[model samples]
Target: MRSPVLGAAALFAVVVLSLATASHGALQYGFYKGKCGTKDVETIIQGVVRQRFFSDTKIVAALLRMQFHDCFVRGCDASILLDGPSTEKTALPNFSVFGYDLIDRAKAAVEAACPGVVSCADIIIAATRDAVALAGGLKYQVQLGRRDGMISQASLVNLPAPTITVPQSIQTFRAKGLSTSDMVLLLGGHTVGITRCSVIKDRLYNFRGTGKPDPTLNPNFLQLLRSFACPKIGGDNNMVFLDDPSSSLKVDNSFYKQLLQNKGVLQIDQALALDPATKPIVQQLAANPTQFLTQFNQAMVKLGAVQVLTGTQGQIRKNCRRTN
Candidate 1:
């Protein structure tokens, strides 16, 4: 028979282990089944997205990008939804990002239905899945159970810049626990968004301070972009499609096709086709839209899983814009 002292010590160890696991709970697909009155959170979110932003492709694109930006900076904790004079939204890289109002609207709907149960973080993940599906992209599953973070600092927003080289982009994504292939696949998210002229002005007129356009960009495409995208030096806020003109509103492989043809709009985008390490993936994605979408959906799932705060580690903020 075991000693009474040994039995008590073993019991203490088991309790401690259980507490640790609960405090770091793993995420699941149906995280809020019984806790809320709904077994289908995806359908509920899809209804809201379709009713409000139906066929409004820009808003759909914004919603998708919102989740990407949120995951990149702070592990998809909904820190991007917070507002302040010095929050992540005020950061230079995120200054022009839209869709906070949409996120707030989605959160309000979720709160009304299941007050104090669903998190703003999980709402973002669900909303993004619905948005992409509504945009004619492949539907994929998103694991939930994320918790809202209490902190959002502009100083901590460190997204990759538009002008970064392929090697630099790889390093940036790798620092976030993503691989080079993941970097290429996640970038396909740009397929449905717009790019501001300010982001490409240097490449258009002053590549490396030479006072000349970037030699890598196709000359004919350069003339076309100059004709409309930036007629003047200070058209900083003017915007253009990031993908081929025909499919800017559709999430497809055309962005890679443009790069292969030397029509890529951003320096970082063109660098993918120009570098040996990433060129093959870019070429493969260009020729295989189905494969691109498949890998993109997979990469996004991985993106959402980064450094997440789960279990009892964080709070479910009643207001997404402020910590509860």
Candidate 2:
């Protein structure tokens, strides 16, 4: 597990998060402050996430990806948390989604301190923010005040596939009210995750049914990838870092830098540097590390507001998996 953020980084993490307002001023920083009566809600959440982060640094990637999966389909609601046969969590896209248990633990901690005070949706956001900072990304604050969603259906899952082209992904994100720039910054989270060979096997073995590797893959990287993952005969599920090996587990601009080298693991990943429309943005982000982290922070906040339920619009679930 990645060690706990320490030294100046921990202090920087505590630096007062900026107050951000949602449409009509629904959400703001510290939304849970004092709501639990002397129990710092975010701090409690941070403690739980920090513990989880210590034991399983993978939670950093899991929680970050969980936020995207939960938000994109149902607008930042915890609909993805509902328990049932046909629920969103049962979808193929969410089959490998982790951190549900982590979120449950965090919610239980909050409930023990102050029952029904914090929203599962807010927990997801806060936990993700904490995870990002632990993984060496920016320590940005997320706006709160969201309520749990009332619906979650596998049929409702429409997340973009890993093979989606740049144009297709641009439209997909646009449909969620995210701009092209936001999509690029958000995808930057690839800086600290992994994808199995099973997910990209076709690109390595057969390109467009031609029985050849993806033309976009650099010849050298192709050999490196085959050696690292996707062996000729077995272990189809072997893990491969999304970013290059040097900075795979750390959140940095290296993912973008690798893209410039034609070393992206996912098709959409490499496409960012190869596509005319997005290549410039990729180059810009690759060159300026600070800008990448800063915009990535803002993009996450934007993602949290997609189609949220606030005020009395949705009930606060005593259990995130079911309605109260």
Candidate that scores best on TM-score = 2
Tens digits of per-residue lDDT, candidate 1, 103-186, equal: 788777777777887788888888887777777688877778999998899999988888898999999899888888788888
User: What are the root-mean-square deviations of the candidates from the true structure over C-alphas?
Assistant: 10.4, 6.0
Superposed Cα RMSD, model 2: 6.0
Q: What global local distance difference test value does model 2 have? A: 0.85
* TM-scores, all models, native as reference: 0.90, 0.92
Clashing pairs in 2: none
Report the number of the highest-lDDT candidate. 2
Pairs of residues at least 3 apart in sequence or in different chains that clash in candidate 1: none
Q: Count backbone clashes in candidate 2.
A: 0
- Candidate 1, residue 140: Cα displacement in angstroms equals 0.4
